[model samples]
Target: MALDRWIALVFVTFCCAYGYLAFATMDQLLPPFMQRNPVWPSTFPKVLAILGVIVGLVVLFGLEKPDSQSEPSATDINYRRLHEYKLGQALMLLGLMALYALSLRPMGFLLSTTVFLMAGSAILGERRWVIMFAVSAVAAGSVWYLVQQVLGIFLRPLPFFLGG
Candidate 1:
């Protein structure tokens, strides 16, 4: 099989896995809203999951099959290289996001988000230290401000290092 086909298959498999997880875990443990509408709880995610499964199946089996013994041209190889770089960056970002999620309650919003943003930028080849730090700080601050002030989510401040 071609490398592109393999990559497509992997992506399709990931979509299927995501859909399965979403389908299996589409419930809120919290009680029905005391003062809000009850119809908004789990509908969106379930709908997205259903769509994901359908798309995954289509992608897995729908694309034109590549020639079995043909080697890709230089340009095709270059494109594949770029594709792999993007895929790697995406996977790292996803991992960092998961870590941030796990650390949200314990480490608080500011710190976890700062780490997530900085790590993701660095991994994606942001070489300027000043830019990375500034971007990370701004990104974290924006999210913190939105959640705490605008949305009233009341995210916890970072530890003393961040000077709540």
Candidate 2:
């Protein structure tokens, strides 16, 4: 896992640098009136930079050092397996997101949303039909009610399934 450690360190470094840049660069061109907002525009990024710095330091110095005594063995999976697994997971997520987006238009709000929730649960390895159906139904109905009746926004109805 040396490579994973190195990758983690690099990611932390990038996050710290990115947050510093956001703090430094946000208001360079803004007018004085805009800068006087009740909240400092740089507040969130500064907090992020602080968090990133702490996390980076922890990763660089605090992790346990691997034992040096074990003999190398052939039972360990190689880097190729890691790469293939990551790629497969990425593709699955991409397909699920595509289905969610496509269904939103034609199927409208409720059914599309239910399918999206069910697909997400499936992707996460949930297989119990009763639980999947119950959770998806509740989630979709809640989102639909909150977005439509409570908020008073006429959501695109599930015209495809419920009929136009």
Q: Which candidate wins on lDDT?
A: 2
Kindly list the per-residue Cα lDDT of model 1 for residues 40-138, writing each as its tens digit: 545676677667656655555644436573655554435435755567778888888889889887787878788777888788888888887888889
Clashing pairs in 1: none
- Runs of candidate 2 with Cα error greater than 4 angstroms are 63-91, 98-107, 147-164
Query: Scored by Cα lDDT, where does model 1 land?
Result: 0.70
Residue 67 local lDDT, model 1: 55
Candidate 2 local lDDT, 1-164, one digit each (tens): 54445766887888878786877787686789888886677778877877877776666673544567364345533564666455765688889998888878788888888888887878778999789989988988898899888999877867664673
Q: Which candidate has the highest TM-score of all?
A: 2
Instruction: Show where candidate 1 strays beyond 4 Å.
Output: 1-42, 63-95, 160-164
Candidates in order have lDDT scores of 0.70, 0.75
